[model samples]
Target: MNDILFRHNRPDRAATFEEYRAEGGFQALQKALADLSPDAVQQTVIDSGLRGRGGAGFPTGKKWSFVPRNLPGPRYLICNCDEMEPGTYKDRVLLERNPYLLVEGMALACYALGVERAFIFIRRGYELAALNLKGAIAQTHKAGFLGSAICGSGFNLELDVHQSAGRYICGEETALMNALEGIRANPRSKPPFPAVKGLWGQPTVVNNVETLSNIPAIVAHGPAWFKALAATPEGAGTKLFCVSGHVQSPLCLELPIGTTLGEIIDTHCNGMRTGSTFKACIPGGASTPYFTKDHWTVPLDFDPVAKAGSRLGTGGIVVFDQSTCMVAATLNLVRFFARESCGWCTPCREGLPFVQHTLERIESGRGDLADIDILREHVHKLNYAFCALAPGAMGPVEGLLRLFEDEVREHITGGKCPVKG
Candidate 1:
C-alpha cells in the first residue's frame, strides 16, 4: 500500500500549501534545481519507466525528450487536466485534495524541460479544483517556489490555469492547444507533433495531471524506488483507478499497477452491490472494450489490458450487473460521444450518429440481423477517422458486438429488450 499520490491527501478538504510543504512537498524541486541537470531529470523519469496515465500510457520522459534541445524559441509544458473521459475523474480528485502536488510537479517538469511557461488546461465544471489550484499557485509564488528565479536557483517559471469552455475533444492534445489559443478547438494533424510544433508552432510537451504529478516523487525517491512500487514486474509505478457503478463502494483510489481486475472488484470494491451479480465491465474508460468474468484475472496494466482485448484507458473501471442491458448501455455511451463530436471528420461526425441510429433500432426492436453487420462495419470504418474520437466512440459498440452479441440478438429476436422484460 505505497500510495504515492494520495499519501498526503486529506479526507474532508484539500491539503493546504503549508501542510504539503511541512510534509516535504517542494524538496524535489529544490533537489532538481540544486543538483540534477535537465538531462539528468529526464533520464531519471525515463529510468523510472513512468508512462503517461492519460489513456495512451506513452513514456513520459521519452515524450519530454522529443523536444529538440537546440530548437529556437521558448519551449512549453502543459499539464492536461481535461479529465473528460466517461467514468474518469481521478484528475479532479487529485487536484481537489492536493493541488500543491501538481504545482511542484509542474515546476520540476519546467526545470527538466527548459520550459519557462506552463499551463494547466482544465475542463469546465471543475470550479473547485480550478479555484484550489489558483490558490496553490499564488501560495507557491509568494513562497518563492514559483515565479522568477525560483528557490534562488536562477530558474524562472510561470504557471497558470486555463479553464476550458467545455468540450470532450479538448481532452485531445492538439484540440486542447487550439482551444488554449482561442481557436475553434479542432485537432491539428500530427507529424509536426506537439513536441516539435505546438501551441502556436513551438515545442510543447503536454503531460497529464497524474503523469506530471509523479515527477516530484520520481525525482525525490529515485527511479528504482518508483519502479519497485508496482505489483507486477513490468508495471513501473502505482495507478489511480476510478471505480464506479454496481459496486459496494464506488470510489477513486490509488493502487499498485498490475493489480488484477478481479482483486479490484472482489476485494477493493467489496464485490457487487447487494443482490447484484457481476455481468461485465468497461475495464478502463468508456473508450475501452468490455471485460467479462472470464477475464477477471487479467492484470489491469497497459500492456496486459491491451493484450486482453481492451485498453487500460484512464483507469476508469465502470461495472455492470447482470440486470444491465449491454445494448442500451452502449447506446447511451454512443449518444454522448456522438453529441460531443467536434465534427472534424466524416467518420466521427457522420459515422458515429449512424452507429447510434443502428444501436437505437436494435434496442427498440426495429433492427434485423443485417443491422448487426452494419454496426460491425462502422466499428472498422470509424477506426480510420481523422482522430481518436470516432474510434473511441465506437469502443462500446465494438465491445457490444464482440462480447454481448447474444444480448443484441435477443433484443432483435424477442422484439424487445430481454433485460427490460
Candidate 2:
C-alpha cells in the first residue's frame, strides 16, 4: 500500500512496461514535455523540496538550475548509479525493479537542464540492473520517447548506460566524470563545479539515481503532493531505506522520509532477530556515524539524523546487535576504504592504512590510552583528505571513539576484547 517509486515493484518480479503504464508511469514525463516549460519543470521540483537520495541530500531542482541557460554546444546529465558504499544498495533495487523509473527520471531531468547527452555511470557488478536499464532505454526509443523528438515535444535526446571499472572512487562526481572520459578515477578539485565545466568540459549536471528518479513524480503529483508524502511536515516524499543486519527481516522498504528509526525496526523489519538485541546502527550508509539506542527514536531524514549526529547517507541502515564489537566492525569498514583508496593523495593513501592498523591493534588488545588518542587524531586528519573517501571511512571509527570509548578502555584494561568474551 505504501508506494511511490516502488509502487509497481511486486514481490515476485519487476513490473512490466505495460504494468508501469497502467499505474501512470510515463504520465509525468508527458506532462512535463507537453505543458511545463523547462523553468516551470525545475520550479516544480524546487517547490517540492526534493533532496538528493545519494547521500549529499542536496536539493535536486536547485542543482538542475545551476546549468547556465542555453549554454552553447552540448550540456550533459549523468545519473550516478555507482552504488559501491558498504551498507548501501538502494539504487540497485530501484533499477532492478523499475528500470523505467530511472529512464523517465533522467529524461525529465535532461529536459529541465537542457541536456542532450545523458549517461548512467553504473557500477560494473550490477550486471542485471545494467541490462535492465539498457532494455528500458530500448523500449523508450521504440516508443518514440527517446532519441529524437521525444513525446513529440521536440526535445531530442540520447541516453547511454556506461559501465564503470568497479572502483569506489567512481561514486564521487568529478571522479566519475574522469572515469567516463577514460581517465583515472581521481577526485577533481571543486570551484569549477560540474555545472560550469564537466563531461568533456561542457556544462553538466550529475545526480544520484534516486535524485533523478524523483523528478517524474514531482512533475506528475505537484510539489505539495510530493512534500506531503514524507512522514514529517518539513520533509518531502518517501525514502527507500536499505536495511540489513540483526533484524528479523532485513529488507529494503520504502517508508515515508522522516519515519522514526524505531518505526522502521518495529514495523518493516518486525524488530531485532532472536538471540540478538539492538545495540547500535549505521543510521544511513556505512559512511555515516553509528546511532546507539538513544537514536532509535530519531527521525531517519537528512536534517533530523544530522541533528542527531550523523549524515542520512544513502538511507542504508545497518544494525549491530549487542554481540557485535564496534571496534571490529569499524576496522572492517576502514580496511575496505584502505584497499579502495585511489592513491590520489597522501593522507588517504597513507592515513587509512594507519587508521586500520590502529583499529586492528585496539581490537587485538594491544592498544593503550595513547592509541585511542591517536585514533581520534586520525579521524580529524582523514577528514582533510583529497576526497570524501577517507573522511567517510572514518565515520564508524569516529562513532567508536565518541560512543564506545568505554569499550575501547575495556580492551586496554582487560588486555583482551570484552565483547569477544
TM-score leader: 1
Window of ten residues with lowest summed lDDT in model 2: 1-10
Per-residue CA lDDT of model 2 for 1-421, tens digit only, reads 3478888887867777888888888898898889989889889989999999988899988887888876689999999999999989999999889998888888888888888889999999899899989988998888888898888788988999999989998999999999999998898998789999998989989899888888788888899988989888789998999999999999898889999999999888999999899999998888888999999888888999999889998999999999998888999899999999999999999999998898888899888789988988998999899888988999888998899999999988888899996
lDDT, model 2: 0.90
* Cα lDDT computed for each candidate against the true fold: 0.92, 0.90
Where does model 2 exceed 4 Å of error?
Answer: none
TM-score of each: 0.99, 0.98
Candidate 2: give its CA RMSD in angstroms.
1.0
> What are the per-residue Cα lDDT tens digits for candidate 1 across 284-335?
8889889999899998889999888899989999999998999999999999
